[model samples]
Target: MTQRTDVVVIGGGQAGLAAGYHLRRLGVEHVILDAQTTPGGAWQHTWDSLSLFSPARYSSLPGRLMPVQPGRTYPDAAHVVDYLADYEKRYGLPVQRGVRVCAVHRDGAFLRVRTDCGDWRARAVIGATGTWTRPFLPAVPGRREFTGRQLHTVQYRSPNEFAGQRVIVVGGGNSAAQIAADLAHARIDLTWVTRRTPRYLADDIDGRALFDAATARRRALDEGRADTGGVASLGDIVAVPPVRAARDAGLLNPKPMFSRLTAAGVEWADTTAAEVDAVIWCTGFRPALAPFAALHLRGSRGRVATDGTRAVDEPRLHLLGHGDWTGPASATLIGVGRPAREAARQIRDLLA
Candidate 1:
């Protein structure tokens, strides 16, 4: 079947929903296509213990803010999922679930969104498919020869399953540290690995601070001014209560990355080998841009080249929630709305 719309927003996650809300306010005819059965996008697949790095006030969409209980703090993954589902209902955003967009090819003046369910031809397309599905794990030598279990953040569910096992958690980001902490408490022998020493943010600093810092840097660049400083990014783990607790318990220490994967385990820089039952890689992810592969977008390094969310190659195309290249902290909840609103305005103009 084939349908037509003024705008097609792909991926009904926070970014797509935010863009949908803005488009609705502008009285634009749009439809959001979600690959998943439910709303919430990648948050539904995140590890159970995951929580927002900032409080609820800082994690909201354009017009509607995320509600928080008086005494409640940062919301968890489940809370975020519930909120995304609720947001769609509140705004009456037209979301068609279980529709996986296979590709967005040019159909003359309009774009043809080829999906599993049907084809959607739209004047504008917003690609908000986040990176959770495209997990990245480095190709260490002898990796294929290893007999032990190898896991990425995508496959990692909980620490309880790894109880009493020798495990190595690799990556320098929050997921790696958090998983290590959880595994450590399960009485598992855990080793934390990073390419370099992990930098801990100030105890009071959180996601908001990181977003502000990114904005500052961008502003400096835009104004053609030299910055007197550089701030850490989202990778800087929030010193949340749980993280602090883990620190106090001496479980967050990180070691340099190992050289290669051995049959039993990994070989270190000093030519030392240690056996481990499981290796969990929290390395990172590339943009979920398979649908746009035909577009031949630039910026090969896990991000799309965009001038404030507008694709450099395709004027009617907008990429969001991939990372900061689209907008300052665009991949984040609070930060995504800013770009989403802007992108929606541009899409409306294009359709007009």
Candidate 2:
């Protein structure tokens, strides 16, 4: 069946839900297509111990705040998943689950979102598919030759599997630190790898500071003022409780990134090598814009060139929460709402 909607949201995650909230508030006819059978999108697949860097008050979508028990502070992945399911139900958002969008093709005036279930002819399309499904795996020379078990952040679940094994964790983000920390007490020997020395924020700081800094810089850009936010980026690791504890325990011994991978393991930058059983790549992800491949809208490094969240070449297309380029800190739960709201407003105008 061909379903016609004024706006078609490609994801039903935090970004998509936020866009739906705004579109409904503005009275735009829209339908949300979700690939996952349940709510929470990528959150459903995250590690059980994964926790947000902020409290419930700071981590919320547009229109509604995440509810938490008074004593329980920061919500974990399950809490987020539950809240997302509740959010969708509370707003009565039109979300169709298990409808994986295969392609997006432009036909004359409208954009046709082709999914496994049906097709949607939308005046505007919102690409809120965040970068979770596509985990970035580095291409080391002997990467394929390594016989050890390999996994990315997307596939990682628990530390039990690598309890007594020598594991090499790659990347400099919170995921790398958290995973290493989780494995530290499991009697596992761990080696951390980073391209550069990771800069960390103070112990007192968390996502609140990150959100504020990003919001300020984004506001400056929106107001036509020079971005004077300096080299302060939200990507810098924050000294979260667990991460700080790991550092204090002398478990965060990170070496400069390795040069190449051998049959046993990676050769360190200093030419010293170690025999490891597994390597966990925490290197971030590129946007999942495979459905939009027919549009030829992607530029260098698979990035969509956007004027804010709207695709430059295709004005009716809005990509929300892809990254900072799409909108400042647009990947964060708190920061995503700004871009989602703005994109929905812009999409509303386009449909009108």
Q: Estimate each model's TM-score.
A: 0.96, 0.95
Each prediction's RMSD over C-alphas, in Å, is 1.7, 1.6
Q: To one decimal, what is the Cα RMSD in angstroms of model 2 from the true structure? A: 1.6
Clashing residue pairs in candidate 2 are: none
RMSD of 1: 1.7
58-161: candidate 1 lDDT, tens digit per residue: 88887878888355587888888988999999999999999999999999999999999989999999999988888887888888988899999988888888
Please give the CA lDDT of all the candidate structures: 0.86, 0.86
Cα lDDT tens digits for candidate 2, 229-348: 722754567776767888898888888988989999889667899998999999988889998999999887678889999999999999998878888778888888888888988887
User: Pairing residues by index, what is the TM-score of model 2?
Assistant: 0.95
Candidate 1, number of clashes: 0
Distance (Å) between predicted and true CA of 132, model 1?
0.7
Count of steric clashes across candidates, in order: 0, 0
